[model samples]
Target: MLDWTTVLVIVLMAASTYATRVVGFVVLRDRTLSPRMQAIMQNVPGCVLISVIAPAFVSSRPADLLGLAVTLAAAMRLSLLPTVVIGVVATGLLRHFVG
Candidate 1:
């Protein structure tokens, strides 16, 4: 159902995103980061995650908010994979039953 212009635009966007990611890797490949830089890099993922999840939790209903709380507690106490699984399953179950 896509026209040629739409397909071209989508392809260009995908290529642009891929190019930026590749540029970051390539630029960093030959350099060694300092301890401070490494710490910053380590914190990036968590910061990004909080940026994404915080708003969702704030806007969610009571049951969804409860699931988010449980998920956050599990994440703090457990490993990443288990935390993600618990969060996803809890959210899905709560939304399904509550809605």
Candidate 2:
């Protein structure tokens, strides 16, 4: 059932993403970022996450909408890490059960 090309693409994409993150740390290893820059960097990941997830909100799919509702509820009560885990698990479950 596995498509080798799709699997290769996914592996390459994951490797590139990991490399960029690692490179960022290596490049910044000797430099001290300004407070403002640090704050901006801190929010970059959250902003990226929002950009990725925002389009799904427009999809009008029940599973996505309900998963978002669950994620939002989790976010209100949990920290960012747990919220992300909950959101991912909730979305997968919703998709399986509702679709």
What is the C-alpha lDDT profile of model 1 across 79-99, one tens digit per residue?
A: 766877888789788888985
Best by lDDT: 2
TM-score quality measure for candidate 2: 0.86
- Clashing residue pair totals per candidate (backbone < 3 A): 0, 0
Q: What is the C-alpha RMSD of each candidate to the true structure, in Å?
A: 4.4, 1.5
- Model 2 spans with C-alpha error above 4 angstroms: none
Model 2 Cα RMSD, 1 decimal: 1.5
TM-score of each: 0.69, 0.86
Against the reference, the lDDT scores of all candidates come to: 0.81, 0.88
Quote the positional error of residue 11 for candidate 1 in Å. 10
Candidate 2, residues 1-99, lDDT tens digits: the string is 999999999999999999999999999999999999999999887787677668778877899999888888887898778888898999999999998
